[model samples]
Target: MKDESLIFGTRAIIEAITANKSIDKLFIQKGLQGELSRELMSLVKKNNITFTYVPVEKLNRLTRNNHQGVVAYISPIDFYDLENLVMNVIESGKTPLFLILDQLSDVRNFGAIIRTAECTGVDGIIIQKKGGAPVNADTIKTSAGAVFKIPICKVDHIKDAMFYLQGSGIQVVAATEKAESTIYDTNLTIPSAIIMGSEGKGISPSVLKLVDQSAKLPMYGDIASLNVSVACGVILYEAIRQRL
Candidate 1:
């Protein structure tokens, strides 16, 4: 956080926000009031940067130097263009296999999904920019170096990824408990993108409608559903089984 370039003063933070830097989050001293503070808060709200209002003591602990009532965490991963990634994969002369995470914010879950997708030979992983976990050190650690080798594309919306996949001739296969067919019965050899939803809400309805096929993982025990990462492993390995 103290890399000089990463740590910014009040004016610097405002400039970075205006420049559209990918800030991970923001921290502001509690009860601080001024025109500049108001503008910063407005900018944070408009840019969707998570902010925590804390006591001055907390800010002091964060940085003894002059923080000017604000600090922003810079993102670790550089995002790529989803369309460009899809096109590159297609041009490489391989059947496309993509995994899309719909609002899956858990870092370990995201990392585990990346590991599974890499092991299963998925062409790419698509995630939404804001709702999902940032590709931070924890994600890289949890992914066990898989994140370095795998291609991950972050987009503004999950539905945009689905539409692009469909336009590129990749069938959208959504994994959900509400689906009629089981994952085992679903065909996976075709060029496809598999989407797994967040644990609580499941896949968003708009994305669900864009899917060409929907299948669920079977459950024999009394437990209703699997963890998002575990379910991702099962479905991705099913695709690997089919392709092999």
Candidate 2:
């Protein structure tokens, strides 16, 4: 999609990546053949950047400029390396607290989670590189600038991050309606990472199997579930409460 955060043209994208710019997504026109396009593909592959090849009509919809078969959305904030962030948090002697999102798609929900995480003293927030919302203008607006204040890491896979966090002695807790224990009963006084799922499907089953524990929020009303962001806020505040 074309926006203030987007940069089109094969050469421009290559240069942006070379400059260490955080590209949220890249779109290439299908059957786009050119020397520069080849170079762009090579660079994208080498860097493990996510890209999609779309039809020319899709390219046209992305931007009216000379796209040269490539367009990318530049992230508003730089992403943190998960390993380094976790290491630093441990070394700092503060009880590690992290929030993880499993394929949460809505930009507004993503923003609200970030705001809540920031307010709750979460050390960082993690989301997958693909199948999740980007740190775009809408997200920034919804976050009210909290997106810039928090450390966010984009991981290749949610399960991998869970494994790493568990290895690092941080417990991975999942929030799901299926859980028997409510958040108040869950242990959050230790180093922990709480995962909130997508708006539609909740956490993927594969990812859920990797978590050390799963808990749900108490619901007195007839509604079966709360919104993802609202659930995240409740879970985060509970963690903060236990720590206090």
Candidate 3:
């Protein structure tokens, strides 16, 4: 983590928020209470920023400086508005192909997915504001700077995003091993969005319920599942192959 990507101290974090800086996540010391803390909390609620309360040791580990019970990670890339992105793609006369990620926290996997999405000419990538991986230095490096080339949108919830995509006439397909059909069976050449979930919990049941279709890669080996990034590549390229 680079020091340039962090804003420390209560007042500093508050100023960053006031300035409308893209904050990936906020960390506050547990049991922190004061007028400043209350004000910060109000701003966090108003801005819908994600935060976590941690021990003082965690703050100390992040920085030896006087952090004043607060640390905010700054996002390297600015997020896009989903509706605007969808409208733009439609206006361009291009079939919109989006990738929606559900609680994918691993930085490397997230980066790899972005890289593949960019190569596949995906219109955008949507993720939850809270549970998704932060666009940090590691993510940028892992993506080979493709993170900057892609339009990534942060939504309040993945389920809501799926609804919006479906409403816009895009088919929402989920990649999960539980599905009986293979990715090759799913038609991806049309306006569509693919939902990739976390490694531990596949896709959330609530979001999966909204998907128009579900498809999976055939696994013949001893391993039950492929890495999330590799699976993402497989599905995205399938879309690319169909479109080509």
Candidate 4:
């Protein structure tokens, strides 16, 4: 992470929050107590921002400057409003195609998924606010600048987005190896959202329950699972093929 992507010092961080800066994460020194810290905590709670209390050494490791036991990582790109984007897509008389990522932590994988989403004409990509990969320089480079071409929405949880998409009459599909059905058999030629999970865990059970359908890629080789980005590409392009 570069200094440009970080907001250091207590007051500076508070100001950033007040100004509505897209902070990816916040780190505060453990056991720090003061009026400023209290105000910061109030703001963080009011905004529902993700934060962690870390040792002073951890803060020092982030920046050598006088950070006043506070540092916030800023998101490189602005996040889109999921509801408005969905409405806009519907009003445009086009079937909405969205990609929802559940706790995907790898930056390169996220970037690659974004690139594929752009190529497949996906309307937007949704990710959980806390666990998803940050849109930073590395992600931008990995996507070959495709990140800028796509709309990314960060929500508090993936399940909520899944429900909203379902309520809107859009089919929500999950890509998991545990599924008995294959992606080719699923009807992806309508308003749909494909939910891909983290590299380690396929998909959270809670989220999987909310999906309209679960589909998996057929595997003939030795590997039980494919890389997350590769799986996403395979499924998304499958949707594209059906639509065409």
Candidate 5:
């Protein structure tokens, strides 16, 4: 992790928010109270920043410097606007391929999926801003620098992105074992975004209802589930194979 990835102190964080820095997440002292803290809270609300209240010990673990009861992890990459990216891809005459992560919690899985997305020529990746993994140091490390090569959009909700993709003629395909059809049976050559759920829970029921299609990988053994990253790579390559 780079040293600059973290920035503490209430004033510095406020300034970063005002400057529109992409903060992955923020940790604030549980019972922090001060005029500067009040100002910082105002800025956080104004910018709709994602943050959580934590113990002072957690803040200390994040940084040893004088944090003034706040610590922020800066995102290493700039996120793309989902609608704009979709429009750009459509206008460019290329069949847009995307990946939508549904509250995926593992940073390494997110990173590996990103690397695969870049390698397979995915147009962009979409994730909800509030949940799932942030593109922090662990994400960047596992992505093997591919995070810089791809455009990742952070939307407010997964369903919103799914609706937008469907409206724009892109199919949302959910990767889960519940599907009657396997990835080989699905048509991946078309404009589509494959949605992978979290490691434990499959796709959320509300979200599963909205996808254009649901797909599953073949289950030959007693083990029914594959790691999310490995499953993502498998499905993506299946798409590639179909396209080829």
Candidate 6:
């Protein structure tokens, strides 16, 4: 209904899939039995596109015009290749500062962190392919267009990302409330990657184990933790402070 939400015909949707466009989700009217529908389903499966089968009435509600029982939500931001971005950063003869999000699902929080990460000169942001917020217009607006300026790498898993970063000579630091050390005391001057977890659960145990170091922000208030985005700012700026 909103301008941010767009509807595409079946051919346009297929073109989007073929073009590797960032798609948040796709919708197909339920019980649309056809050869073209089978091909669409095959493409969706191949591309790992998230889609929902809904009643034709719901499709009509989404768009007044003929949607051909198909519509897709396109994402505003483009993802980067993690390994290439890292290699480029290293080849530039500068220390790489990467931020990794472990299962962070809140869209606004993610946007806020991108804004901070960009300001702090973070080289890139890494997020898991699944269990993360879809990058949409809200993220772009909330980031104040930082999403365009900063590189975001979507990875298959957090642990795999940690492994690659570590193997590449960057220290992997896990930010968690459970850490024994405070971020203020930890050393961040080295080329490093920081992992920020979800709002509810902290970093996954498997991921935490792979980190080179674990640190947390000191809590002095009644609340046990700060919002993920707020914590990201404190930690990232602290890194910037330490580097400068």
Per-model clash counts, in order, read: 0, 0, 0, 0, 0, 0
After superposition on all CA atoms, how large is the RMSD of candidate 2? 1.3
Off by over 4 Å in 4: none
Ranked by TM-score from best down, the candidates are 2, 4, 3, 5, 6, 1
Expressed as tens digits, the lDDT of each residue in 1-244 for candidate 6 is: 3766575678778888888887777889888878777888899999877678888888788788778889888877778999999999999999889999998988899899999999999999998776788787778889999999999998877888888999999999999988999998888999999999998987988878778899999899998999999999999999999999
Worst 10 contiguous positions by lDDT, candidate 5: 1-10
The lDDT for every candidate, in the order shown, is 0.84, 0.91, 0.92, 0.92, 0.92, 0.88
Q: 1 or 3: which has the higher lDDT?
A: 3
**Mind giving the per-residue lDDT tens digits that candidate 2 earns over 1-244?**
3377889988889999999899899998889887888888898998899998888888788778788888888998999999999999999999999999999999999998888888888999999999899899989988889999999999999989999999999999999998999889999999999999899999999988888999999899998999999989988888888888
| Per-residue lDDT of candidate 1, residues 116-209 (tens digit) | 8888888889988667777777787889989888888877788878888999999999999999899999889989999999978999998888
Model 6 weakest 10-residue run by lDDT: 1-10
Off by over 4 Å in 6: 1-5, 29-32, 52-61
TM-score of 5: 0.96
In candidate 2, how many Å is residue 146 off? 0.6
Candidate 5's residue-wise lDDT over 11-86, tens digit each? 9998888888898899999999989999999988887888999999999888888999999988889999999999
Candidate 1 matches the true fold with a TM-score of 0.81
Clashes (candidate 3): 0
The TM-score values for the models, in the order shown, are 0.81, 0.98, 0.96, 0.97, 0.96, 0.90
lDDT of 4 by residue, 1-244 (tens): 4558888998999999899898998999999899999999999999999999999999998999999999889887889999999999999999999999999999999999999999999999999988778898889989999999999998998888988999998999999998999999999988999999999987999999888999999999998889999999999889989999
Q: TM-score: which is higher, 1 or 2?
A: 2
Show model 2 residue runs off by greater than 4 Å.
none
Error of 2 at 21 (Å): 0.7
Q: After superposition, how far is residue 1 of candidate 2 from its true place, in Å?
A: 13
